[model samples]
Target: MEVRASPREYDGTFVTTQFGAENVKRAARDEYRKLIDKHDSEDVLVLTGAPTSTDAFRDTLDEVLPGATTPYVTSPVVHATDVLNQTDDRVVLSDALRRELRHRFLADYEWETEYLRQASEQPSFIEDLDRVMDTISWQNISPEETPELREITAALDAFHNWLAEHDHIERGQLIPEALDVLTGDDYNDIVDINAVLAVEFEEFFPLDRAYLDALTGDCDLVCIAEDDASVRRTWVETGAITDYVSFSESRRASGVQPSTRPAATAAYFAEETVVDDPNTGSVSVLAADSGDNQLATIANEIEELIEQEGWGYDDIAVATKQSGSTVTETIESFERSGIPTESATITGFGDDPAIRELLAVARHLAADDDNEVPDHGLELDTDRLARVGEMDQLEDAIRWWATDSGVKERIAERETSLDARSQFGNVRRAFRMAAFLDDTAFLDATWESFEEMLERAHEYASQQNQTSATDLDGGVRVDHLQAIKNTSFKTVFLINLTDSEYPGDPFLTRLFPTERVASMPDYPGVTDLSNTDVDQTFPTDSTASSRPFVQYHAEHARRCLAIGAEAATERLYCCLYEYEDTALEERAQASRFLTAAYADLPWVTDAADPKITSEQAAEEFLLSRVDNALADVRRANSQDVTISLDEVEAELGEIQELLDKSGVRGEELRKALRARVEFANGEVRR
Candidate 1:
C-alpha cells in the first residue's frame, strides 16, 4: 500500500495536491516506510527518478541494516528487468510475465484506448480484434486460459463501454483478470490494434490526424523503434522539449517538424530570473535569450525580479501561444522551479498532474468514508458541505454522492418531482450524473459545481475547446492569452508568433469556389491563394479598400505589442525563433510586431544571444516553406487523392504568387507545380 500524501495539510486534511515528479518520490518513500512499519522490508524496493534515488539512498542508510539493503533504483530499464528477476524468477518465466509484457506493449499505444473500447463495443470489431489476437496466439496454454481470456476480453469491453457512457471512470474498474487475458501473443498485434482501433473509434482518430495535418501538423503521433531481436519500442507522447527546440530538431532531422506539433514557440517557468541589469536599472541585453529559456530559467529570473524590483509572483504570468506541447513544458518547468502552474486545455488525464491529484483525493476519500453512503437519496445543500470538515474531504464526498449510481438514481427522482426551468433542470441534472469531484464545502463549492454543470465539459476538455484561467496561490496564471487580452503581463514571452504560427489557419470545413477571393465586404477582393499562384491581374480599383498583409499582421502584432505596453512597469520580454533563416529581412519580419514597435520603447536581447542575421533568417523561412509544401503533399495523399481541378488551379495560382515574390520564375517552381498537378490528377483518376 502506497502512503501517498501531500506535504501541505490544510486544517488536518491535506489540501488537494498536484501529483508531480516530487509527489511520485514522496509516494515511493511512504510505501517504503509502510513496508518497514509492517516489517515486510525484504519484499519492498523503491524506484524513483535519478535525483530522488540519490536522496532516498542517503535518507535510508541510517535505518537499513548493512548488506540487507533493499534495492533503490532509477531508470525503468534497470527497475523493470532487475526487479522482476529478484522478486519472481518463476513468476517472470511464466506466461503471466509474458502477459504483463503484452500489457506494457498495449500501454505504449494506449492513445487508442478510446478506439479499442469503441471497437470492442462493436461486436464485429471485437470479433476482428479477437481474430487478430488469436492469429498471434500459440496454443500451449492451460485449459483455464480460454475461459480467462474470454473473461478478460469481456471486462475490457465492458470497461470501455462504461467509460464511454460516463464522463470519467473510476480506476479499479479494470480487474486483474483483464490483465490475465492478455499475453505475449497479443503483444504482436499492438500496432495493428492501434490502426484498426483508430478507424472503429471514430472518424476523429484518423480523420482528425488527416485534417489537422492539413491545417497544421500538431496532432498526436507514435514512433516505433525495432531492435535486432525483432522487439519494438514505441513512444507516443509529445512536447518534452520547448517549441524552438522541437522545431529546430524537426528542421534538422526531417526538413520540417510535423506541423502537428502545434506551432508553439515560447514557454514560462516559475522562476524569477528577470531580464533587468542590476547595474543600470534598465533592460538587460540578456533579455532576448531570457524569454527563450525553460520555466526553470524564467523562475530564477522572476525571483530576481521580486528581490530587486519588488515584484511578486502575482505580478507575472508564464504564457505561451500554443497549448499542447508548449503548455506541458511550461507546467513541468514551473514544477521544477517550484512555481505552481496549470494549463487551459490539458490532454489525457494521465499527463495532467492536477486532474490526477483530484482523482487520487477522490479515491482516498471514497475509501476512508465508505460507511457514509445513505440508502436514502442525498440532496446536496452546499451549505452542509462544510459540516464534512476539510474542503478536500467535502469534495470527495460530493463527487461520490454526485457520481455514484445510487446517488444519480435518487437525484433523478428529486428532479422529476421539482418544478424548474428545463435548461437549468438539465444542467443541474448533469451535475447529478457527473458529480462535482472538487470539494464543495469550501468557498470553492459554487465554482466546483460548475466544473461538471454540463456533460459537454468532458467533451470540451477532451477536444481542448475551452479556455480556463487558473490562479495557483500566487498571482501566477496559465490562461488563454486571448482570454486576458489587453491585460499586461510583467514579463511576457510571446511564443509561436511566427507568421504562419500566430494566426495559423484554423480548421476549415467548407471548401469555397477556387475563384473566390478572401476579402471582407468593405475590402477589395484578393484571390485566396493556397501558397501557389496569385492572379494580381484582378482589376484594381484605387477606390476599393483592401485588406493588406500589414493589417492582419498588425492586429496580431498589436496584440503582441500591447502585452509589452501593458507591462510598462516591468521589463517586457518577447521570445521568437527563426528556423533555417540567416537573413535580416526574415529576422526582421519574424518579429514584425517588435520591429514595428521598435522606436517607441526600450528593447533588449538576452546574453545567451542567438545570432540572428539577415541571411540565416531568409534561409530558414525558405526552408520552412519548402518543407511545408512537401508535408502538404504527404498529408494530401493520406486523404482521398481526388484532386479537384479548382484545387489544381489554386495550386498554380499559389505557385505564381511565390514566383512573383521571389522575382525568379525558375524552371524548378514550374517543375514542382507540374509534379503537384500530376499527383493530384493521378489521385483523381484513381
Candidate 2:
C-alpha cells in the first residue's frame, strides 16, 4: 500500500484510505496499520466516507496505534470542514446529535418534513438532503422537477438557519465551505499535503475527489484500490470502484484456496471434466428439505470439520445472502443446534438487553417518579437502581444505576461467550452515549432526546457502522455475504443461495427510477463506468418488467457471489434448500448462479461419499439400523423373518441410551423403535 514513488520531494504524511461500510473501514484500518508497521512506517491520518463519527474511529486508532503519533482520523467532510472551521472555530454537531435535534425542532416549531415524502417514498428526508448536499446536485435539476427540487433546497436552508441559531454547523456544509476555502487565496492543508496517497479508495464522489485534489494540487495523489481479490493498482478517479477483476482461469482457487467463480447463468451443464476426491470436499453444493434441516446440516458439518480435521470454530463462517430477519433466524438456528456464532451483522439496539435495561432507568429518571427499573420480564440482578448520592450528573447517575442493578458487573464478568462479547459491545456504546450527553449542548437535554439519540446510534450501529469479522475474536462467524469482503476463512458456508435471494431485487428509490441511474449526468456514480453495463450478467425476474433494474442488480449479485466464493481459503459450501417456510413463494430452488457455475465449480455431491458434511454420518447409521430392524419386526409373523428378541432388546437399549443423551432423540425414530417392541408383545398394526 506504499505510495507509488511520489514525484514530490517532501515526505509529509501517511494518509491511508479504505472504502466500504464502517466495519470494513475499521477492519481495513487495522490491516493497513499492521502492513504499515511491517514496512516500518506509520500513518498520520485516516480518511473514511463515514460522516457519522470520528470518536469511534479515534477509539479504533487509540486501540491500535496507541501512544504513537496517532493519526488524525475522521470522515472526509470533517477533515475539510474542520480545516475551514479553523478560521472561526465553530462547533460541529455530529450527524447523530444533529438528527435528534432536527426532530426536536420539528416538533417544537410544528414543522413537517412532509415535502421529503413528496419527493421520496421512504420519507427518509435527512438522507435525501444529505445526498443532494454532498454532491451539490440540487442546483443541477431538470426544469420539470424544479418545483420539487425547490422544496428540498428550501428545506436545506431552513435546517442551516436552525443550526446557525444554535451556533452549530453540520457536515452538510463541510464540502461546499471547504471547496470555497480551497478555491480561495489559500488553505493550510493545501501546503501541508506535500503528498496524498489514498489506499483502496472505495467511495470517493466527484465532490470528495475535487476537494482532495484541490487540497493536494500536484502532490502525490495516488489512490490504490484494494477492495477486489483481483484488483491491482487499477486507477479510478471517481473513487467508487466497481470493476473488480474477474476470475482468471489460472488464478482460480482449487482445494487449497477457495473462490466462487460466478457462472454465466443459473443453468447446470454437463462437463467432461472429472472432479477429484479431495477437490470435491473443497467446493460443493449442499441441498436440504427445509431451513431446520439446512442449519442442522451446517452445524453437523462444522462439527465434522472441528472434530475430524482439527479446524477451530473461528476458521468457519456462515455468510448468508439475506439480511434482517433471515440473518436473525440463522443465528437462532445455530444457537438451537448448539453452535456458537458471532454475528458480524448488527441485530440492533432494540434487541439488546443491557441497553434496554439502562434506558428503562433513564426513562424512570426523566419521569422523576421511581428509582426502580422494570426489568420487562428480563432476569436482572437487582430490582432497585440505587442512587449513589454523590453526583446528580447523568453519566454518573447511569454508572451508579448500572452498578446497583448489577448490569455493569454482569457485563464485566462475561469473557468467552458470543452473547457476552456482543452485550459488552452494546454496554460500551451506552457508556459512550452517556459521555456524549455530558457535553455542553446536551446539558439541558431531556430523557426523550437521550433515548432518541440512542435509538439512532444503535440503529446505525446495526446497519453498517460496526465491527469487522476479526473483531469477533472467536466463534463461527455469521454475517451477510457483502460484510465478509476483504476477509478470508478456512471453511465458508454461503447459505441461502436461492433464486429469491442470490440475485436480489434492486433497491430503486420512490424518488427516482433505475433507468441508467448509475449513468445519468450528475448521477453521483456517473464516473464509475464499471457499473455501466451488464452484458455478461444474466438478468433475474426479480424486476422482470424492468430489464435495466434487473440487470443492475444481476451484475451486483454476480460480483457479490464472487466475493463470497473468494472468502474461503480451503472449503466453500454453496448451499441451497428445497423448501423454506420463510421463502418468498414457500418453495425454494437453487440459485441459478450456482448451476451456471456448476461446470466450472468443484462439486462432489454424494451424500455418503465422505466428502459431503451436510448430513451426519452417525445419525444416518442409526436411522438405517432402525429402518432395517423395523422391516424385520413387521414381518415377524412370516416364516422368512427371524425375530431375534433378546438381541433386538440389547440393540434397542443401546440406541435408547444414546437417544436419552440427545434430549430423547427424534420422536419419529422413538415411535419406530416402540412399534418394533410392540410386535414382540403380539400387537400388530400397519
Candidate 3:
C-alpha cells in the first residue's frame, strides 16, 4: 500500500494535492497554522479570488489561530482597492453612471435616442453597456476614430472630467493605477506583509498575476490547488505562475472519516427505500412539472424530512444554479410551508419595492412638462406638479409632494415588512440624497444629467445595502451553489438540474466574450472563462470542469438530494370546460448526469393524462371550487373576519347535495352536515 503524506511547507510555499474540498481546506489550515507558528508573527495576508473563499479562509484562521486577532483577509480586488488604499481622489463610476453615460452617448451620436430611451428601462440592456465598455477597454484602442465609439468615449470623458473637478477618481481606473503603484518603488511602503496565502484560486488576470509575482519575490506564496490540471496548465502557459513544487497526496486528518458516496442511481427511484438506508446516507433526485411545482415539491419534501426523519431545518440546505426570482419563489414557498428559510446570497436592490417606487417617482418627475399649478397654500395639488417643467417649480412640487404624499411613511411600511430592512433603509437614504442633489448639484441639470444623478444615488444605496447571507440566523439555508461551497449539511437539495440550467452557458457580454476575454494577454484576473467548456455530463475521472466541481461538492454532503422539472404546463379553459394539455407544455430534458446515472431506471410518469374525460374534467373543476371555498372560510375564521353568508350558503348547498346523492345517511350524514353548518356559522360570525 502506498502511504500518502501530509502537506507541509517546503522552501516557503505549500501546495496541497487533495482530491476532496474538505481535505483541501484541512490541509490549508494545517499548513497555515505551521507558517504562523514558525514565523512567530501575525503579519499574514490571505487572498483569494472570491469573497466566498475569503470567508472560508477566515473561518479556518479563527479556529486555528484562536485569540489571535483575525489576520488581514480579503479578495484581490478588495485588498487592492480598499485595504491597500491604492486608489486616490478619483472615485469609481457606479454601474448606473456607466449606463447613463452610454445612453447619452447613443442618443447624441448613434442616432439611437429612441432605442436608448427604451433600453434604459431594461436592467439587462444597462448591463450590456458595461460589457461594451469592457470590450473597448480590453482592445486598448481609442474610440476617437470610430464615430459611435467617439460618442461613447466623449460621454465617458465628460463623466471623468466631472469627477476630476469634484476631486474624485473613476473606479475603472483603480486596477491599472493600483498595478502601477504596486510595481513602483513605493509598493513596499503600502503593503507590508510577511507571507501571502492564496486559496482555492484557479485563474489569475494579468494584473493579479503581476501582483502575485511581485509578492512572491519578498514573501512566501502558498496556494491551494484543487482545480483541474488543464486549468493549472493554462495558468502556467499564461505565465501566471513560475515553476512550483506540489504535494499530491491524500492526507486525512485524525478522526475525520470520508463521507460515504452513495450509488449514483439511488436518486432516480420513486421510493425513499431505494435511495436511503437506515444506517448509511443516500443520494436522491426529485422530479416535478415546472419551476413552481419544483419548489412546492421541495418544500413538501423538506417539511416531511423535518417531521418524519426528525431532522432540524438547519441540517438541510437548498441550493440553486441561478439566483433571482427563483430564490424569491423558493423562500416564499418554504415560508408558506412554515419552514423558516434564509438566503445565503445578496439579492440585488433592483427588485426592492421601495427602490422601484422611487424610480417611478423620479421618472415621472423627469418626464414632467413646464405647466405648473397655481399656488394654493399648502394644499397645492401635487399631481398637477407632474406637468410642471421648470426646474424651480418642479423642485417646489417635489418638496410639497414629499411632505404631503407621506413617501417616508410608505417607505417605513415597506422597511417593516422586509427581512433585511437595512436594504430598504439604504434605498430610502438614496431617494433623499437624490432629492437633495436635485436642489443642489443638479439644480439646472439636463434630463440626462438628472437621470445620471439618480443612477448614482441608486448605485450608492445598492452598495451600502448589499446584505451577506452569512449574517442570517438559523433556518434552512437557501443559497446559490457558489455560496454553499466549503460548507457541509446533513442533507442538501440541489434543484434546477436540467441541461439548460446546470452548468449554465457562460455570460456572453457584448464586447468581450468570456472565452476571448479570459484568454486576452492583459486580462485583469482569472474568471470561469476556461471552465465554460467543462462537460455537462456525469462525473468521471476525466471530468475537470465546473459542472463536476459542483457535483462533487454537492455529493460531499451526508445525503445529496436533487430535483428537476420534466415539463412546464399551462392550463386552458373553454367556456365551462378546463383541461391541461401536455402538447402545449414545454419540456426540459433531464441533465446528462441524471440520464447517465439512471439509464435503466424507469421514468416517473405523470399521474395526470393529457386527455381528460368529461366526468374527470367536471370532477376537477368541482374539487378546485370546493377546495378554494373551504380555504377562504378557514382563513376568515382564523383571522376573526366575517364572510358573506349568502356566498357560504351557495357553496355549502352544493356540497350537501353531493353528499346526499352519494347516500351518506344516518349519523355520518348528520355529523357531516353539522360540521359544514358550524363552519359556515363560524365564518359569518367572525
Candidate 4:
C-alpha cells in the first residue's frame, strides 16, 4: 500500500479530532485495533474500494500499529493477482500483458470461427473485439435472443482457455478463481484468514459482494460505508455482516466549524442550495481562455495557497476528469512553473527514450527491415545482436540482447528525469510484454506489429484507470478525479470542467446494443436505474434506448465532482477552460454540471480585476500610481492651477526609490505589469 499517495496534509492549525475524514479514520483505526486484538494479523483481511482509500487505510494502520506488522490490506482491483496467486507456476498478467495476449489470440483466431470471420471484415474489428472483452459480463445474454451472443461466448471461452493453457490468467478472473481454490477442503493450505473488512461498500459491485459473502460463516465480517441501505440489503439480511455502525455526522478539520467547507461544497452536487457566508472561503470557480491558461492560473493560485495561507505543497492536489494527454500536459505545465508534482500516470511510457530504446533493439533483432533501428544514438551493436541471432525464449532473448547492449543500465541511469518512477515502471512493463511472446511471435514479429502491441497494451492498460500516485514526498499531486476519491487534501482543484470533455458521451459497445445492456438491473456501473435525484432513468421510447447509459455516465461525473468536493477539507476550485488551444481554435461551453454548480457557488475567480499580493504586483501598482500622478501634475500646470506638493513630495520620493529598484519604467512595466498573460517561460509566451 502506498501510504503517502495523498499525503494527509491539512493546511490549517486545527485539532485532528475536528477533521471529518480524520474522525472517520479514527473510527476505522479503532475498528482495526479491535480486529487485530481478537484475531492474529494473518487471520484478518482489510479491503478498500480504491487505491487511494487503500493508501489512506495503510496510513491509519501505521498510526495504530506504529511499526508493528499490519494485516493484509488491498484494493482488489489492483492487488487481485497478488491475492489470487495460489502457486509459482502460473503467470499472472496485468491489463497490459492481458491485452497483448488477447490480440495474439485474436490474430491467429481460426478463420473458421463465425464471429472472428464476420468481425474481420470491419476496419475496427480488433478495437470492436477489445471493447466486447472489456464489458463487465454481469449480464447473461442468451443466444436464443441473438446467435451472435453464442459465437461471442465461444470466442471468450477459447480465449480464457488459451490463457490457462499458457499458465496465465487475466486480472478479472483472479477473484473468482481464488474463491474456487479457497472454498475447497484444502483451502487452509492456500489462504488462512478468519476475518474480513471491506470499506467504501457503496462502490463494491455485485461480484465483490459475492466474494465478501463467500468469506463468511467461520470468519467475522464487517463493512464501512457512507451509506448503509445497500450493505444491509445485500449482506445484513444474508447474515454475512453481523453488525453495522454509522458515523452519522462526519466532521472535518476541527478548527472553527469543522466539516463546514466539505459539507457545503457537497450540497451543490446533491442539488441542495448552500446559504453563503463570504468568510467561509471554501468553494470557488475559475474559467480561463484555453487549456494552458487554465493550468497557469491554477499554478498561480497554488502558489498563493502556499505563500499567503501557509499551505504546504503537500496540502494541495489538482485532479482532472480527463487523463492521459491531459495528465501529461499537466506534468509539463507544472514543471515549467517550477512546481513539483507527484503522479503515477505512466501512459507516456511507451514513447519514453528508454522504453523506445528497448523496443528498437527488440525490433532490430527480430524485424527484417533495417532502416534506422535505434541504437542509443551510438555506433552499431548490430554485430553482437545479429550474432546472438535467435534464442529459445522471447523474453530471455530480449534480456540477453539488452544485457549485452546495456540499454537497461542506461535507463537505470536516467535518474534526473522527473516522474522517473513511472519511467522505470514502464521499462519493467515494456519488458513484461516480451515474456508474452514466444519464439514464433518474436522471430516473425514485424516492426509494425511490435509497435502495435505496445500501443494496444497502453490503450487497454489505461482503461483500468490506475493513476496510483506515489508517496507523500512534499510535492503537490496531479491525478485523475477517481484516484483522489477517498484521499483528503487541504485544497482540491477539480479541473477540465467543460462540456466537450466533462460528463463525456458514452461509447456504444461492439457486440451488444445499448438497449440490451442498459435494461439489465445487474449492470454494475451505476446505482438505482430509477434513482430520481440524479435523474437516472430508463426511457420508454426505443429511439431513446441509450438514455440509461448516458444518464449513468452523467451521474458518475457528478459523483466524481462530489468526491472532489468532499475530499477538500478547506478549499475547492472547480476549474474549466473556454478553448483547448487546438489548430482550429474552437470555443467550448461550460458543462451542465459546472453551470448547475455555479448557480450555488458564489465565489468566482475575477478575470477582470484580481487582488495583487506579490512583489511584482506591488511594482506594477506603484508604476501605475506614479504615471497617473505625473499626468495630474502636467494637467494642473496647463490649467495654471497651483497643486500642493508638500505632502505629495515625500510620497513621490518613496515611489521613486522603489521604481529605481524595479528598473526603468518601461522595462519594469513589461516585466511586472503585463496583463492577459496566463503563462510565460522566459521570453516564450503562449
lDDT of 1 by residue, 167-263 (tens): 3222111111122222323323221111100100001111122221221122122111100000000001011111101111111101221111001
Estimate, for each residue in 205-317, the C-alpha lDDT of model 4 and write its tens digit. 54555555555436666565542112112210111121222322323322222345554655455334454643554677777778877877787777777887898777988
Summarize candidate 3's per-residue lDDT along 1-686 as a digit string, tens digits. Answer: 11113322233453644234455567678767877875644677887655545665677667877675776677665665663364364544444443444444444333344544555565565455555554444223354333444544555566556556755444454555566777778777777777877765444443454556565556766766542311212321221122323322323333222233232122331012222222334445566556655665566666666766687777777776555556665666666555667555544354455555445555555554536322222332445544433445334544445556665566666443334454444454444444444543423444434545565544533222121233554577776555555555666766766654533454434444555534433332223322222222112321134452243222222112221110001110000011122566657665554444444433321223223223323343444465567778788989998888689779868766776676544336546445555665674423
Candidate 1 TM-score versus the reference: 0.30
Best by TM-score: 4
lDDT of 1 at 128: 37
Best by lDDT: 4
Clashes of each: 53, 2, 12, 7
- Which candidate model has the greater TM-score, 1 or 2? 2
Q: lDDT of candidate 4 vs native?
A: 0.57
> Per-residue error at 564 for model 1, in Å?
5.4
Q: List the residue pairs that clash in candidate 4.
A: 18-254, 19-251, 19-252, 19-253, 20-251, 20-252, 252-259
Q: Worst ten-residue run, lDDT, model 1?
A: 226-235
Error of 3 at 415 (Å): 6.3
Q: What is the C-alpha lDDT of each candidate?
A: 0.32, 0.53, 0.48, 0.57
Where model 3 places Cα greater than 4 Å from the true spot, the runs are: 1-14, 40-42, 83-87, 101-126, 132-173, 229-280, 303-317, 323-348, 367-418, 428-479, 489-491, 503-583, 598-686
Residues 420-445, model 2: lDDT tens digits: 77777677667766766766573464
Candidate 3 weakest ten by summed lDDT: 566-575
Q: For every candidate structure, what is the RMSD over all alpha carbons to the true structure, in angstroms?
A: 29.9, 9.9, 12.5, 10.4
lDDT of 3: 0.48
- TM-score per candidate: 0.30, 0.64, 0.60, 0.71
